[model samples]
Target: MTTPNSFLVISALGKDRPGIVNALSKKILDDGCNIADSRMTVLGGEFAILLLVEGQWNTLAKLENALPELEQELDLTIITKRTEERTPSSNLLPYAVDVVAMDHPGIVNHLAEFFSQRSINIEDMMTSSYAAPHTGTPMFAVHMNVGIPSDLHIAGLRDEFMDYCDGLNLDAVLEPVKG
Candidate 1:
């Protein structure tokens, strides 16, 4: 049995600071809302926040109304929308892809294009640029979690992707992610 509830997916962006999350979480508690799941990170000088908030219908409404004050006070930009809690898919196979190469433009773009052409779904991705270990040359790395349809041929996909990476001068590996 499922209980009746409401969910709000929120994204907030603003200058990084000491108290932004604390303030928001405290306010949510005061408004009788619960934090369902969240990921917060700092990108350069700015902070990015994404969270799913759960509560009853009326309390969720009240929290929504109360947010304008925080937006104005913190000079933050916020976007919120009602959302459904999604269950994980059992029909797709999880695969991990990692790439390392000289920091160059179009690497991520080309990778995205390749996956999009195959109708692949990217679940999550993380990328970073740093100095090479031996030399001081800039290096880029990307790790992504992609969902391949169960009907897709993993061997063919792996072979084609490796060839594509070789053409791009990128070192890449694709392997199944553990359950």
Candidate 2:
């Protein structure tokens, strides 16, 4: 019988520069670990990375143990945690949420509170701020993947969500995330 692969979640933050991905990927490869999934981006002046890695237990242990040296070599603050593959819940329906508005504070917090109050889970979210074209007005946008309870009333939820967005003066969409 074969043992199941172990999982590790790694988050790294450091000064933005070229070759960070290359170096990080190379290290994972050399350590006999596979990048199962990752999100990498430059946030302000820092490069942020999140990686889900899979490997044999010993291999993952080696990789985890080497993190200190990797941090020093790459000049990153690296954090690692062992994790297991998620067993998705069948009682949840995947939904995508998009919102755009004039840039202001508390938009994310407000949205989070709304979902939390309804027992909905925000699986993933990405937000950005930019200058609007022509007018150069400051604008903010958010995209989120949420898990809505399957037993919930979709029409009611949509109506309520739209009304909430309208009250906030946010242009928003709530729809299924089609695979």
lDDT of all predictions: 0.92, 0.96
- Tens digit of per-residue lDDT, candidate 1, span 1-179: 86677999889999999999999898888999999999899999999999899999888899999898998988899899999878788988999999999999999998999899998998889899999878999999999999998888999999999999999999999999978
- Residue 114 Cα positional deviation in candidate 1, in Å, after optimal superposition: 1.2
Tens-digit lDDT track of model 2 for 25-112: 9999999999999999899999999999999999999999998999999999999999999898999999999999999999999899
| TM-score, structure 1 vs. true | 0.92
**What is the overall TM-score of model 2 with all chains considered together?**
0.98
How much is 135 displaced in model 2, in angstroms? 0.8
Candidate 2, run of 10 with poorest lDDT: 19-28
* Top of the candidates by lDDT: 2
Best by TM-score: 2
